[model samples]
Target: MKNLSVFSLFLVINISAVFSQNHYGKNGMVASASTYASQAGIEILKAGGNAVDAAIATTFTLAVTWPFAGNIGGGGFMVIHTENGEVTTFDFREKAPFASSKDMFLDKNGKLKSGSNHNTALAIGVPGTVAGLYDAHQKYGLIPWEKLLERAIQLAESGFPLPKSLANDFFQFAEAPEKYPEMQSFIKRDGKVVGFGEDWKQPALAETLKKIQKEGKKGFYEGEIAEALADYIQSQDGIITKEDLAQYEAIERSPIQSTFKGYQLYGMPLPSSGGVTITQMMNMWEQLEETPIIGSVQYYHILAEIMRIAFRDRAKYLGDQDFIEIPELEKLLSDEYATELLEGINFDKAGESTVTEIHSIHEGQETTHLSVMDANGMAVSMTTTLEQGYGVKMQSPDLGFLLNNEMGDFNAVPGKTTNNGQIGTPANTIEAGKRMLSSMSPFIITKNNYPFLVIGSPGGRTIINTVFQTILGTTVYDYPMAQAIEAPKIHHQWLPDRIIYEEYKMAPETLKALEAMGHEIQMRSFLGRLMGIKYNAETEFMEGAADSSSPDGGVAAY
Candidate 1:
């Protein structure tokens, strides 16, 4: 693998520069939501680090540079494929506090208490980011852990101009900070919320990072920082305690493996429905005779139908594997299951459906994803989130970080219809120490035993469909990596029974054709922000692209 580094570097420099919007490099590449974060990963790679090292650097840097989504207070999943052909997954998703209960958010009327679990201290879950990163570094990192913290620490202490995207996010959540005195103090400038382009610094977060750097994971879970976080949450009516933090652990799970059109796909397994849903959708689509043309009416309709079927199963069977009797993966990915699902779809019209007696849980769309690959062929795709923008909309005043409202991800009440019209299943019911079901899907695809595509997105329920479309575009449709990522995407998650697509991203005639087919269509501002890096086997160079929908998304390679 080391011997291939020189050849990769040469190919990266001479790959015809075919895709202008994508960053291409032979030695390494990093695609993330922030330019600074991506550069941080590339720097680690250039400094003789492995893909895992670069991923760690990028993750921490994003915690400082892309606050709304990138985070230290949040939790997520990571899928990694090492050069030696070994694949692994890390489930660092937040867990319910011991005091949490199935009906904690229910009112006296037995209905979900509106906004009770969304933006409050009680919404906070035990954080796992610090623990997860530390575990990953201990296992696979090549650089000193303190080295990765330097950039994030400096950025938090010295401050950086708020990028347009983060600034806009701040502005949108402007009124939120006013409710929490701690948040108000951080964002206020002379009694006004900080505006876009202002220099923003987080001294408190820097201090917290220093502690973690010195004491490893214990610095965050057992020491002064943990005490402060627990005390703050308790004062705010939240259930988090020092014990919850101390008990948090990032588990290394087996990567869900499947094959699509002769290419192998590796994704994060349960706790996340991502891997199963993706594999199921692909299996169903494979039953079709021809790949639908990208952006065409037939294409959208077929994909939407497939998504609907997959999401239905997602709701029915997916959850924390440890707690639920999840369906067998072999059976779910079998051709017979695909055949059974295919029979439910009518290509000529949308299928009629009714809400079932189940619970519908929705994870927030506010999240971040990053993809990194080193010249050695080691690759990583990770999706992390705060559950919502500035999660729970409550910052830990002492910690200078937001707490995850992942508790909202649980089914608050049975027999209730979610805002999206999907019923929640018992499989997702909350329990003490139970991990919430998530829609995050980070994946790595391999061709003939070589790394081919590293991809993932940040779009809550839309993540499965987004990654599905990208894979289809690149593999089945033979589109370039940039085109596959930038192309319009559509989503349909069963109970909703309507195709949601980006406005004007599809041709008017194609949309009209879909309408004629009896499909209900809805327009959305955007569906997802996808980031990916494709390994060009012919050129031996990696090409990375950031979704056009994300204004601040960037790619760096060297």
Candidate 2:
């Protein structure tokens, strides 16, 4: 069976239609990239859990069901808007081990060592998922911590039905055994292609989850699991150590807040380039005197220019704030300052990009996101990832999990900038214990104390733009959650200076207009996978929208 692409789903969503059918019970709802994980969330919610509890349950399940991105071996960010009016964010992004360096990915000749940054064991970052999720659960979860791991443990032990796409992935391992040697967990003894609907079980993974279920985060970071992770990485010439794993801590940060069209948006700040870049773009958009109607050529042209400027700023100024001071953050995110920056934009012509290097240039659009909202009004939006699909493709023989190549996200060389989108910006230079910069944008929007939307997406650098477009589609154009998610989105990172749009989704006339406006256009089969829940004020319902970009994505709600 062929998967249905969002390009083929063109049903319009008026507010009335959204309220009538898309609405779920006020008790809880979940929108995520995996049906298995989304169902896990609904179960937790029904078991007397809040949104945060459901999110924890969903994340661990995704680690089992959507291994390409979700993982206990990787890390991510979580944003929560509690019903009591508190907004908080957690940064569980992966960090460089103590023995890492700035030139680890560079050769003695000062050139990049091909595949070193992302394809080998050295690319692995210290895992942070356990720490991040545990910290959040400790603070706000309504259910017992071990209970969250039950569904994941059961699936890993008894085996869950493999989706078609995952079967295809296993088949690839069968076809190209040499290229995908690390995929041994899925390798069958008979040497045959794996098919969809087959039971996929992992005894080792079940054991690992049981350990966490018994001992909490320590099961992963301090004892047997830690020893296995460190020993395996070291055997592959990697730098992780037990000390690195033990010292890792997830940090709680203040959520970045901004206003657009009278609605307030709360997003993850700093290490994540998502919040700041999106803030800058939105500020510039609000300042534009010639704001065109949605889907117009003028609309795309202006937004691209805005995206270009914001991304250029991202390259030069954004990073782990703990490592460097971003004195420009306050000014840059200010709407008053945006009015000053827009003075240079011609608006009629596309702007040329001057920034040539990017801290996160190597990241691809391979990550997973989950959005959960409970009856109590707690909304959790989370985005987690490895640098690319299957991460470094290094799965531990004992752990049954794939590790992240997040080190590729840091600047690999000092004082080096490239024409092909590599950069050695000081803010993102590799440093022991420093986190790599990211584009994970998990956000919550509110209108006068009412939670309006719990939203987030995963598309590497395109994530920021995807979030921006989703908000525009919903708030500005009044599209329902699904219609907004399926609508075409565009991305422009200053360097590369090209508009990336979903292939064939744009009108011929719109593309021509953008090209004539001095914009260079490129086509991508898809832009992002977004999981969001829109709050219906009139009906008091939560409308969950799971992106159709992935075949197995679903909204598990009541």
Number of the top TM-score candidate: 2
RMSD (Cα, Å) for all candidates, in order, is 6.4, 4.0
Which residue pairs of candidate 2 clash? 25-558
Give residue 167's error in model 2 in angstroms.
1.2
Q: Name the lDDT value of residue 371 in candidate 2.
A: 94
Worst 10 residues of 2 by lDDT: 1-10
lDDT value, residue 54 of candidate 2: 96
Clashes of 2: 1
lDDT of 2 at 148: 96
Worst 10 residues of 1 by lDDT: 9-18
Error of 2 at 29 (Å): 0.6
lDDT of 1 at 10: 28
lDDT of 1 by residue, 1-558 (tens): 222432332243234223327778999999999888999999899888889889988998888888778888889999989889999988999999999988898888887777887878888889988888889889988889888888888988998888777676666556664565546655655677667777788888899989988888999999899999999899889999999999999999999898888999999999988998899998888889776655556677888788877787788778888888865667887889999889878988877655652323576998899999999989999999999877876776678887788988888876567646535567888889999999999999999887899999999888889999999878887767777787778888876668888764665666667778877888998888899999989999999999877778899999
TM-score to true structure, per model = 0.94, 0.95
